[model samples]
Target: MPPITPRKPQRRALLIGICYKHTHQDDWPELLLTHRDVDRFRALLRSRYDYADDEITVMKDDEAVPSRLWPTAQNIRRELDRLVRGTAAGDQLVLLFCGHSDQLDTEETKDKTEEDGQDEVIIACDAKRIVDNELKYRLVTSLHAGVNLTVRVLSLS
Candidate 1:
């Protein structure tokens, strides 16, 4: 048998949790434990998967600092762009989102994809709605070939 090569896949993770500090149309309840959930997942990534602290980008509403970005729709899109830019073949990217989700009617029905004619969205800290199609276009379609991307979304609503 020939010599075997070790599998050391390049792993990257983006963890986002929104507690909805502000709201617009709906009186959404604030999530007390969503931030904790992301923290726990971060721990798991480090202890179980050996992910470095610098390798993870955390965007939380209550825990937002100057260095760490906030969980806004614009920020999320920008981060997704950054992740796709840094990703290469055989690289692993994990995205985790914990917040409120809602189903809304989408325009441009000619290219409608959702089965129920309504688009699922993740509400951001600024009360902005990020449609599922937008996520797929920015994160999924932008990934390079052979890149492993996993998205975990935990919706409180």
Candidate 2:
């Protein structure tokens, strides 16, 4: 009898990490926690998937990334969509963000209600704050991505 051939599986990985400080501004904070997240996330992917170190992409909220590729909430959403749609089926995508997860009141607004027409939104690392509309945009983009999605948000716990 002829030998049966096996079909190999394909996998994909994506990364998002926040190396910035929310309480105070600095180029980037120097903390072991940040390093821990970097190591832990890499190890998690390495142990589970057969991805080479280079195959995985690391993104930060700091200057390490080009101003264009910074891991802003919107950019992260877009990259996730790309990773999910770009990879073949059976592949996986992982996203991690570590920093301040907060809400702020800014000068942006829309009619929330007849009484409370003005509203504010939460921003991540950007100097600007985001609003409900932006959040919705990001979410919709992610839903349309059509790939296995795994997201992790790390805060001071």
- Per-model TM values vs. the true structure: 0.85, 0.57
- Residue 27 deviation, candidate 2, in Å? 14
lDDT of 1 by residue, 1-157 (tens): 9998846667889999887765454656888888898999999999999999988988887644553488888888888888778576789899999999987876642337677788888888888888888889999888778999998999865
Candidate with top TM-score is 1
| CA lDDT of every candidate | 0.82, 0.55
Clashing pairs in 2: 16-96
lDDT of 1 at 97: 96
Cα lDDT tens digits for candidate 2, 6-90: 4454455566566555425553343346546866788878887667876576766565567655667676656655655545444
Range of the 10 consecutive residues with the lowest summed lDDT in candidate 1: 105-114
Misplaced by over 4 Å in model 1 are 1-9, 22-26, 108-111
TM-score (C-alpha, index-matched) for candidate 1: 0.85
